[model samples]
Target chain A: MATSVEQPQTLIYVLGVTVIFLASALIGIMYLAQIDISQEYTLYNIQYSSTVSRMVNSPTCFALEESFELPEGYGTETQVQAGIIDWWKFNSGITKVCSDGRIIYAYLSSLDGTLQKQLLTGRDPLTALSDSDLESIDNWNTKQEKYYVLVYKDSQLIPAILEVRIKG
Target chain B: MKKAGGAFLTELLLATVLVLIIAAGFFGIQHIPGFSLEPEAKALIQSVGDNEICNVNLLNLIRSPNEDGTLGDTLITSYLTKDYTVFNETTTNILNQVMLRRWVMNLSINNRVEATFGDPAGFVAVPCIAYVPLPQPFFSNCSFSEIQTGFDGYEINFTTPDGNVTMEIVNQFVTDSDKIGGFGVYPTSEWTTIPETAIIGEPTTINDTLNADLLILQIYVGDESEEVLIPYELTISEPSEDPDGLTEVHLTKKDLVQQCSIALNLFVELNNE
Candidate 1:
């Protein structure tokens, strides 16, 4: 065979192909990495005001049944009176896990400069969820009767609601 | 020797290319899970919940009224309609006005959902953390339901296709109850003696031709974005010394006046209306 003469030509072809291939590969890799983060995020807010109007015309049952009453330290006049309590932030996430392996989580977000709250404990762990139990609090199921699932990101108000009950 | 060296270099290049291909495939496969929509969508919801919390809380604080003259009920109505209530007093006053910060609210609703898809019927879905208040006892089942007077619970009505949830919510503020002692239920044009109970003081009713003046429990609802244009109603009933003020501080028990009958009977309607 014509060994020496063909060697350099073959090397040139290989070099050209390799360059194009690596370029395409890099583009594909970066595109894949960004796919999950591309979509616009919608925010779901839950707010309340000392002003009754800022509170929803109708509150979720958990709060209403509780008579809008809070503990002395839970940010009320009594708590402030005690002079021990300091600041307060509208909280969201897991509250308590029932004995029956049910989970409950609270979701509070902002809407039109007011606090609007959403509460739920959804089940149905993603089939893809591994046993690894990652520390993704924003993600992950609690131990209460997972009821509602808020589907959104960050914008103005809560976006969508999905049921989170674990069914057979 | 030169040929040997060249072959070695060729082998190294081939190995490196192979490794590159394997690594790319591995990483490419790892990304498939992230592409799935559910987890991302859920995370977005969680983030939205987190992002808006601060704004809502601040809004709540700004909208809350102070003790000097701008009481909560007044400022809250003002806030509903977007009326900016400027702090008339200096910052020192606000900081010193400890009563202004004492306000808190909680929520409780009677959630009635009729489960149809092979589940139990008349199932109620009540959420407790929806409280606007920190300490939650004030908002009880009675208050929300209008069943038990002091916010006992909610009355839930539900529908299916799109579950129409009708609930009564109880929002409460726990002031220093002890300070609000001896609130004489004197017959202020709005109260009356419950027929049998002899009022300690001579009862006085609004002499004018008012409708339902015998009961008084004023409730007002205003469009939250506008400050001035608000709609409210004053209700009055057999007025005698009654629990006019709700305070949480320490106070001497002068003499117990009256109590809003554990009945949610108070409604807002005027003679003209």
Candidate 2:
């Protein structure tokens, strides 16, 4: 009778050890998975910030005032250059003359938020990005970035915001 | 008694087998679809983070623009006379401490400015020391000699073939002890020495005699080059009435590229402690 009682106790002890071992293994796996996910998110944030910084510092964006040629109806070369600068002050347009990317959209607006222009490549204001993608830009989180550059507007240099969103 | 011992040992063996099976199942979950490790993602994140840090550090080394949008004189002197040994040591420490990697910093300036005025001459070439990192045996295969002891700051001496253009970038920090406060570029050739009084409390001038229609100063920190341009017509005259007047020079958007851009690249490896 005593031997029978001890047999059940040994089985119980063995079962308890097995349960503890299984629980420890499960927790370890979960911890590793969490670590990996955290690392990935950190990396994504870094890439996003770097991309935005690069766009803001691009030389092409800074040299936008000197990028246009004299349009046919815009007087002489000097007048045309001046006209382009003036137009950029209030008008939004896209230029095919991009150094790195396929298209560059230059958005111009006055400080008082009076005038707005959106120029698209090929003289069409439409962009290749879907409406949803463009709308997403309005709801940019801290990850997305926009740079406001001072462009020539009349005699004063006004601020023009340049937002670059590259989609595949 | 023998039968009882056999049964106990069998129970222990069964428990061991059960635990091994459960552990295997838990660990094998990572092998499931969409759960594999992404080494590329981790590397991309690390590289971008490293590059951004390097950019910030390098920009901090440059002189800040004054209230009037002109670089100060002391800043220029410090820039010219900055000890590379100290710079490299500081940079390496920051990078290693922050990044936990063995890395080196390389600096090279490319002054190739195209003439936008007068006769369109070719690029004005400023000879630079090739990419040389401190503590030899790392990036030792460089064309130009490393900075030696007792060496004065960098000197950029260039004269166009026509003798019309003569430009000299002397180490003002070493030459003149008094002009040591602000940062700027004072054109001091063998024939002409710009008085410190001219730049004191005045807008730093890009002398009209330099004949440089456009001057692009490129600072390369690894493979990346950040260029700042000094255009053909950037002259701010001294105030006639107030000798202590400040000349406010307006900088266009084009000038901001050089001032704001941080272009530095560094290769970082994970430090296995």
Best by lDDT: 2
After superposition on all C-alphas, the RMSD of every candidate to the true structure, in Å, is 24.4, 20.2
Which ranges of candidate 2 are over 4 A from the true structure? A1-11, A27-54, A63-108, A121-144, A152-155, B1-273
DockQ values for all predictions? Answer: 0.04, 0.05
Q: Write down the worst ten-residue block by lDDT for model 1 chain B.
A: B260-269
lDDT scores in order: 0.28, 0.36
lDDT of 2 by residue, A48-74 (tens): 554444433433333333434553334
lDDT by residue (tens digit), candidate 1, B22-140: 56765576567545544545444443332223232323333233453322333333333434243212222322222111212221122222111111233211111211221113322
State the DockQ, from 0 to 1, for candidate 2: 0.05
lDDT of 2: 0.36
Instruction: Indicate the TM-score of model 1.
Output: 0.23
Ten residues in sequence with the least summed lDDT for candidate 1 chain A? A78-87
> Which residue window of length 10 is worst by lDDT in model 2 chain A?
A76-85
